[model samples]
Target: MENHKLGRAPDFTNACIVMFGVNLGWVLLFLFAIYGLVAAVFICLIVNHWLNWVAVRRRQADQLYAGKTPG
Candidate 1:
């Protein structure tokens, strides 16, 4: 079993799967951002989503590891 501290995909396999989408989305969206305001919004959205995912994952894993069901 692996310890997923920081909500980083649970394991190497999962991490790769998750990062593939993240990287691909970033590349595509960066190209899509033609205007300055649009670019800022895109970047903020990307970063916010990533941070939320990390925090949520970490919390869930912590709950599960401590023998509590993740809600």
Candidate 2:
């Protein structure tokens, strides 16, 4: 895992999962203190969508690359 990367294939999903947890836990912890429950809920929803979307994009890219012949 030490050689794992963040945004590239193979390691991307694992990195995304780690990022999701950090954003949900630490970022929301501070947001809750500053903006309270309602605002934090909205922020959480937005963040969730963004993260999922990015993950989807990465996965699709991986599939595309896998099917392409080396040049």
lDDT (C-alpha, whole model) for all candidates: 0.80, 0.83
Which stretch of 10 consecutive residues in model 2 shows the poorest summed lDDT?
A: 62-71
Candidate 1 positional error at 5, Å: 28
List, in order, the clash count of every candidate structure.
Answer: 0, 0
TM-score, one value per model: 0.49, 0.54
- Residue 63 in candidate 1, Cα distance off native in Å: 0.2
> Model 2 clash pairs?
none
* TM-score, cand. 2 vs. native: 0.54
Candidate 2 structure quality by residue, lDDT tens digits, 1-71: 99977885464888887997887798888989999998889987998899899988888888778995333
Kindly give the stretch of ten consecutive residues in candidate 1 with the minimal lDDT sum.
Answer: 1-10
Residue ranges of candidate 1 with Cα displaced over 4 Å: 1-35
Q: Largest TM-score belongs to which candidate?
A: 2
What are the per-residue Cα lDDT tens digits for candidate 1 across 48-70?
89989999999999999999999
Off by over 4 Å in 2: 1-24, 68-71
